[model samples]
Target: MKIVLPTAGKGTRLRPHTHTKAKSLVHVAGKTVLEHIVSRLASLDADEYIFINDDENGPQVMAFMAEKFPQLNCWATVQQERLGPAHAVSLAAPRINKGDDVLVVFNDTIFVTDLDRIPQLCADCDGLIYSKEVEDYQRFGVNVVDDQGLIVDMVEKPDTPVSRLAQVGLYYLKDGRGFMDFLEKTIQAGETVKGEYYLPAVFMNMIRAGLKLKAPTIDAWLDCGKPETLLETNRYLLRDRHHVHGEATDTVLIEPVHIEKGAVVRNAILGPNVSVAAGSVITESIVRDSIINADSEVRAMILDGSIIGDSARLVGSARRMNIGDHSLVEMT
Candidate 1:
């Protein structure tokens, strides 16, 4: 089985953090997003690994793979153009064979599913596409299935209430070469939306050709696209509350908080959806619903709904937070 991960998008929503590193390298819940994703899929034991990275992030990804997944046969390649998803996947055609089982997953969103069972589950089908039932269907590309639960069509941000099974970016093709040929034809046909070809078009064309593309359901879809979702994923991951490093020194730690090794917290209240990464210090501050990245210092400030980047120094005085009765003073 060949596993492909496309990390080409330079997470502009993540700002200063992504400016220096790839979006997948962004730290969350004591690990990089890429690390969490790779670790989760480690059990699959894929035969080959293909990482689609941007030009600037290729070295970083390769370095990460060398350290984390050194035993696996991995190759890092760059997506020379930002045309679309189909174009990005096409870059791996050189490494793909006709009958190889290809599994393409986007790195921004991680889904919870038993990937080990996929081979047996899709043995009778030509391909599989994982989707989740979402209420906000218009915000994503949804898959339309027939009575047999096979994908018949797909609509990107539909005008009406088409389908709630939002495609969460996990695709498996039993015939990898057929998928690549469809992608090439998609590019040649000039079938594009917003000036770029999309993966839905390729899959739809494959379905039209009598391919049984089954739409399977996933357990959970955790999106790490932007800051809000990154923090949200942090909270979701920290649900395993055993992450606290010894007893807090002069600090009160709330549950569901992850304090990594080497993070010092003193005279502060932290928790209930917070993660203090390694090498960070927090003193005389109340941090909640936020992620304090590595090598950062937080002193004497009330931080909530915030994300402190790596090596950032944040200092503020809380003495002026005192306000009289009946006055609601909220920091924006």
Candidate 2:
């Protein structure tokens, strides 16, 4: 099987941090978002890994992958234009062989699931889409399944939802060439929503051509596109994998917090959902539900639901903040 990852988005929602690094590189729970996604696929045997990225950060992503996953056959292509997901996947067509099973994942979302079952599920259908039952169906693209449990239609942000099964950012296609063909047709037809071709539109086209796609449920889907979602994802991850390996002298350590090696904490109350990266220092502060990046420092502050970037320094009495890398903010 081959893997296709679309990571070219500018991540305008994740501002200052996205300005310095790719959205996938944002740290949460001691790992990058891309690392979290790749870890989920660790059990699978992939022949090739293709990443569609923006021109600016494409090389950086490739470099990171090469360093971390050198054994895998990884390739990166720059998406010069901010076309769309479908167009991004199309860029990897040259590398994928016909009849090959392909796994497509979006980089901005993190999901926890038993990925080993995907092959078997895809074996039973023409394609598979991982979905979660979400209350806010209007906020996401959803799969309209019939009574038989087969996806009949794909609707993007429907005004009146036909189904509650919102499609997560994961997909599997048993026939790679067939999907490529449909994607090409979708691009050629110029049938775009908001002037951009969507991957679901191609799936809908395939369904119209008699392809059967199945929707499978997952354990959880966490999005990291916006500030609130990113912070929530941080909390979710830290809740599962939290430990203190660094010094915290005279500090009140709350349960479920991660203080990485080389971090120093003193006279602080660190929390139920917090992750302090390596070399960061927290002194005389109260932090909860926050992520303090590497080499950052927080002094005499009460921080909650915050995301401090690498090498940032925050001092004073701010309750919440989103400080970017190498920034200095002194509030009173």
Best by lDDT: 2
Clashing pairs in 2: none
Write model 2 residue lDDT over 10-129, tens digit each, in one string: 899999888989999998887889989998888887988999999888888998898888888888888888778899999988988876888999988999889888768777579889
Indicate the residue-level lDDT of 80 in model 1. 86
CA deviation > 4 Å runs, candidate 1: 318-332
For residue 118, model 1's alpha carbon misses the true position, in angstroms, by 0.7
Cα shift from native, residue 136, model 1 (Å):
0.8
Off by over 4 Å in 2: 317-332
Q: What TM-score would you give candidate 1 relative to the actual structure? A: 0.95
Candidate 1: which pairs clash?
none
Q: lDDT for every model?
A: 0.88, 0.89
lDDT of 1 at 278: 87
Please tell me which predicted candidate would have the highest TM-score against the true structure.
Answer: 1
